[model samples]
Target: MRTTPRRLLAAMAALTTALLASACGGGDDGGGRAASGELTMMVPLFGTAPDPKGEVHQAVEKVVGKKLKITWVPNAEYGDKTNVVLASDDIPQVMVVQGKTAAFVQAAQAGAFWELTDKLDRYPNLKAKSEQAELNASINGKVFGIYRVRPLLRSAVLYRKDWLDRLGLKVPETVDELYEVAKAFTEKDPDGNGEKDTYGLIIPKWPTPVFCSASPYNVIETWFGAPNCYGDRGGRLVPAFDTEEFYTANRWLKKMVDEGLVNPDFATLDSGKWNDPFVQGKGGIIIDVNVRATQLYGLLKEQDPDGYGDKLAMGGNLKRSDGQKFSYPFDGYNGFLAVSKQSVRTEAELDEVLKALDRLATKEGQTLLANGIEGRNFKLENGYDVPIDDDDPAVKTINNDVDFAFVQLGTWATIGMGVYESMPTSEAERENLRLRKELAELDLQTAVHNPALPIVSPTYVSRGATLDPIVSDARVKYLAGEITEEQLRAEVKRWYDSGGAQVVAEITDLRAELGAGGN
Candidate 1:
């Protein structure tokens, strides 16, 4: 169940290696067409594959008017399995591929998967998805798959509002003010336990500059004027660590560590356990994904059914000392869905599969996929579908089945909020939903787009898996005061010597090739 970030990273690396080792092959020869009204698919499963005879499966088949044969691959092994399937010419008619990976790009370029650009316009719901997501999934400026859309940016500072009120402190509005708030939460005993045990902030272990919902490094760097990953410098693209802003951000984090304002074990802390201190009332603030607020609120209520439910709050887009506020935007996709030419074998079969997927993009399809059978899993109330017998074994089984059945297809933010509003029986969940929506909207106003997101460099494709850890280790060392600014710069030089410079040059050429300018 993705027990740890380190393990997950290791698994992904293994999968990438397996996929890269697989031999490239020709596209499907249009030989195995499913009988009329039947389709086969392979999708990643978060848990065990659900029973095909389950009510959720029946509901989906009834809605889409098709009989289905699906292969449920565990998410950790999906990439490797997909690679083996493609190499053996045993791929499903439809499959989910990690679009950003080098293996998928290689396979796509080799004509292993069908390109969907021309077919997209024929499906209204599929075409309605975010264009930027489609762009993010593109290979050499060509769209090859239908992207699964998610929020573009949703990072925020989640704090204990009740504690803030008791301490007579206001929500932080700037970087400096945020530090001050953290200091106060540490020394003021805001929890009123009359002990010096509470921390103002909980900094979780972050392995990279990638925006992790549970980590503060990315948000802090953005506030300090560092770019998401690459920044525009004199009309050329450069890594954020090469700039002075990255140094300043590292210095600020070091100061926080020296002051004991953040968790001391942050460099080694497990991200899954990041919320433990907050839930136990030993910390007051966390920089995390918007959805975590709801999860945290639920856990807090379960721990203290009568109290502490309404204490949590979320805030975001805090201004910097320079009067700028920005949040890094994401690629806005879960992954992507691709069709295998070998499996479908004909344009007519592809169209039938596309039509079925198009149905999944509709409101009815979304509702079914997200909530399961209405009367069985939920009931209508005041225009909302309140869950029914959520803890029942049958209901739980069906709900789990939905995750493996199909893709969410389109914007899940709105549909998710609706589900949240309908299911949470207490005010805390509702408040979490409200705060999530608020922060999401606030982030939209000042989201910073990464110019390098859609451009894949050959150097990065070959050396990134090795170099990223080096950079991350150096950053953590710098923030922990184990390395000086000069030493950090030395590490960056080593990075360049070890292929980062080549990556930069390739990305620059790619940007020019695509006519994308440095912002």
Candidate 2:
């Protein structure tokens, strides 16, 4: 999902303060060294936790010169569990904290975490990354965590080239053309199945905040000239839904639903099930992360060995009706790492932890963490680190399954962009990466950045989480024809009366303070 400072803050505020300060504090004095070179950590697991006894884990421990203890919380429950841990003051020495969370802001304000602003300069690798990302991660203009670098834009339209070729259709270049393509894909039997079972497009039930890569709403909204999250209106910052363009986009999507070009149950469809139709050859298009093109290709080929799965292609950003192209811009960092004073206690221990993290940013550290033991998981072949075997137990043990353990400290995009470049063994894989990189670069040129990104709104911290669902649900209902346009407008008005107005005011004030102009 596309996470924002406001959303993270809201999730953080859900815990009770009594629970946060109840745990026993760390035993270290405010020194720069830990008595024992042992570090404890807690991070959200994107998949199953890696075996601690695995070669990758052992390799990381050897590089950092410390014995490690880590708790891998599932992503779905991470926010709540993190709250419980923070409330108990029982956080690990190193913990993953959403830099924009309210709990973290409150903790930082209360001196519960170290101020890394001045300390970051000492670590060359950490300081050399994006200064803007560090700014985005700051609270009250002070840095308290180390940001994990991510791409600024990764969204695009992925379609079935084989189907398009069979139908004698070219890649759509405009909003109207996209609609026509979807219509044809749905009714023209592009799959040659001799049945009307395919859909033109696949849409999620609720698509906003542009968080998930699969959310087509954001890309579709761009076509109607809507801004990302918040838009500029005559020097005032306003919620995107407050604009006429957003309403137009909603009506456009509703037309798709009414015409049966999109999945009928999309309003209530689970996100996990969103990709099933496309992968099973029942859908023709999807708007998602460019990397999914590679993944979808693999799945398609596996499901139909001789089918046209090999003809999937990535499409460029389509031009809006106004003749301009735009894509949503992301805050340029993933979740950041913060050291808890309740765990580390002393400045020395914090420094010790920081040093290890700094090492992880180096070439030696990144290579080891990304590829694992060179000879074990991969080997130098013609100047490239090639995978030994896709099915090898050792290879699987040291690959990305364990990357979550050590790669988060400071992975630069420059280092990661070459990941697909160096490892893709097939021409198809190479083409996917090449197309992804090309689209990302193009998106960069037309990205509409969120002006409220660094601005913190108290209204949002208190009511945003609640109001977000109200707006999202309303939009979904309106698109599904469950609600009228007038009712949709009323809901938007209700949102403003509730707290959206305050959010806009805070963002507008912050924009003025930062010397930024609107409209």
Candidate 2, 1-519: lDDT as tens digits: 124434345444444354245323444432223447776788777665778887777877787778778788877787777766766646677778755666656666666667788898898767837665666566645677787777777877888788898899998877888899999999999989799988888876653432222257766776577877777888888877788988898888889889999988887777777668888877888877776776776677778667634668777777877678877656787777787777676667777888887876677666776555677867777656677786986677666554554454435632344332356646766777777878888878887766666666766766766677667778778888889999999988888888878878887887778775443
Query: How high is the CA lDDT of each candidate model?
Result: 0.71, 0.71
1-519: candidate 1 lDDT, tens digit per residue = 000012123343454444334323343343355436776778777766777887777777777778877788888787677656755546677777655566566566666677887778998877836666666557656777777777777778889887888988888878888889889888998888888988788977864443222247766777788877777787778887788887887787788788988888888888789889898888888886787777787778788888766688778767888888877566676667787766665677878888888887677877777666778878887666687897899988876775444433333523454332365667776666677777778777787666777677766766665666666778788878888889989988988999889978887878889887554
Report the CA-based lDDT of candidate 2 relative to the real structure: 0.71
Candidate 2 global TM-score? 0.88
Q: Relative to the unseen true structure, what is the C-alpha lDDT of residue 277 in candidate 2, on a scale of 0 to 100?
A: 83
How much RMSD separates candidate 2 from the native structure? 3.6
Off by over 4 Å in 2: 1-36, 46-53, 207-214, 307-309, 344-349, 380-385, 389-395, 400-404, 407-410, 413-422, 514-519
